[model samples]
Target: MTGKERRARIVELLEGAQAPVSGTALARELGVSRQVIVQDVALLRADGTAVVSTSRGYSLARDARPCRLLKEHHRDDEVADEMYLIVDMGGTIEDTMVNHRTYGQMSAHLGVSSRRDVERFLDDLRSSRSSLLSGITSGYHFHHVRADSEETLDAIEQALREHGWLVPMSDYEREALR
Candidate 1:
């Protein structure tokens, strides 16, 4: 199929998908290379399509949620607890961001919303030899969380604070939460 036709097909396929669609799967179905699918996806986003790339793959962006940036600190071993606390309080851990003296700001997608998701994320990090961003900044970092409501977010903040994970939001970091 032509490139335009292929992209149309991609939108159709993703529209009904129950889960994120992998680029490899899309490429195979469209008889194109994965790189081409990636480019096509980029072009789609450039055209204002709401496709989000998750760890699993690509899925259409859902309606925006009420999200907040929370600063937290903990040891490496306490990572799972922090994640669990947020998810258990009806918060979806959208992503994590950290500022580096050298790299400026760095971020990564987490998409963690459950204990299982936290476990998987922890396992992947351990098995991949990747270090947490918090490690770079003395256990200080931020999480963008989508909660069911402001009450839920308040509860999450309380829990994090009670557990001694809440860090004071700095003036430099406050603006970025928006």
Candidate 2:
């Protein structure tokens, strides 16, 4: 099959999948090398496909409906505040998403729900001497918080906003994306 056709199939397969599908699995299905699959995914993303890379593997971002929520907090509170909020709401921090005015989309895995999960993730980061995006972004960050439903997610957003932890997405900022 041509590269274009193969890329289309890869996107279709990812969108239909409910879970992360490994590059090897995709390569097998497409009768191509895993590297080819990765290249195709990159092309697809460059063309504006919402493909998200998770720790487990790759999945279509649209396949996982992003819960409606907003959170904005100081860089200093990123660890402790995230842990308390996710645990209090009985949800997990699926990912951290940030919109760069000049750079477009950027995100990372957070994958946490409990205090222990938070501690372990933080510990791992420290042990690895790893740095986060915000560390390089002048302390600006955002998140794609997931929960059971819109209501639950909204509740968390509201609480955070009330506590001066979240900043509302202004009409101008929302319009800029369009």
Candidate 3:
């Protein structure tokens, strides 16, 4: 099949999928190299197809309606604490976004769907010796979450705040939540 046809299929798959689709899986389905899949996805995005790329893979950007902001503050060290908060509230960390005081906004694609995903993500970071987004921010980070209700999202925010993993919206006031 042609690249265009493959991309269309990918978009269809992403639209129907309940979770992010991995690059390897997409490559396998299309009988193409993973790099080619990546390039195709990029091209699709460039054409404004609403395909949001996350660290886990690709997901179609289709929020049901009524835009909601799920805000939370968390110290970097308290990742597990925040993860529990999300899991308990029937929410998952959709993405991790950061704003460097110097570098503007930086984001990492973390499609953390479960506790195991969180653990694997952390383990990968450790094994790869990757650098944290901001060294100065005292373990502070933000999560874009998807949940059934606003209350659940608020509960996550509250839990993160209680654990001191959450940073206040003031000071630098960088929005960690989205």
Candidate 4:
């Protein structure tokens, strides 16, 4: 198949998938090298496809939900609590981001929508001895949160605020996010 045809197939596969599709799996299915699948995904992204890369693999971005970017700060010990609260309140923690003085912004896809996902994420961090991206920014970070409606997001925001985890965004952050 042509590159264009392969890319289209990638999109179709992702759209129909219930879970993220790994590049290796895509490559095998498309009869191409993994690098080719990676390049195809890059090209698809450049062409405006909402393909989200998560810890497991790539999936078509879910745009049906309303999302909000929330700035928050908390100690490492509170990570589980924060995640559980969001998921329990019907919000999906899509990703986490931090702005560094030198690097500007860095992010990682979380895809944490349930308690199980949260536990797996924390377990990975422990097993790998990896620090959270927010650690570089002194616990200050941003979360891309998605929920069924504006009201759900608002509830999550309020809960965070009540927990003292919510931080008011700096003017620079506001402008940069815009």
In terms of TM-score, how similar is model 4 to the real structure?
0.68
lDDT of each: 0.82, 0.69, 0.66, 0.88
What TM-score would every model get versus the actual structure?
0.66, 0.60, 0.56, 0.68
Question: What digit string (tens of lDDT, one per residue) describes model 1 on residues 67-157?
Answer: 7788888999999888988888789987777777786666677789999999999999999999998899998888878877888998999
Give the per-residue lDDT digits (tens) of candidate 4, residues 71-131: 9999999999999999999999988888899887777778899999999999999999999
lDDT of 3 by residue, 49-156 (tens): 558778998998875522223334445576666776677767767555555577655555566768788788888878998856544454444556767777776777
Ranking by TM-score: 4, 1, 2, 3
Considering summed lDDT, which 10 consecutive residues are worst modelled in model 2? 62-71
The candidate 4 region of ten consecutive residues with least summed lDDT is: 41-50
Candidate 2: where is the Cα deviation over 4 Å?
Answer: 1-66, 69-71, 101-104, 170-178
Tell me the deviation in Å of residue 33 in model 3.
29
lDDT for model 2, please: 0.69
Candidate 2 has a TM-score of: 0.60
- What's the lDDT of the predicted structure labeled candidate 1? 0.82
CA RMSD (A), model 4:
7.3
Candidate 4 positional error at 41, Å: 10
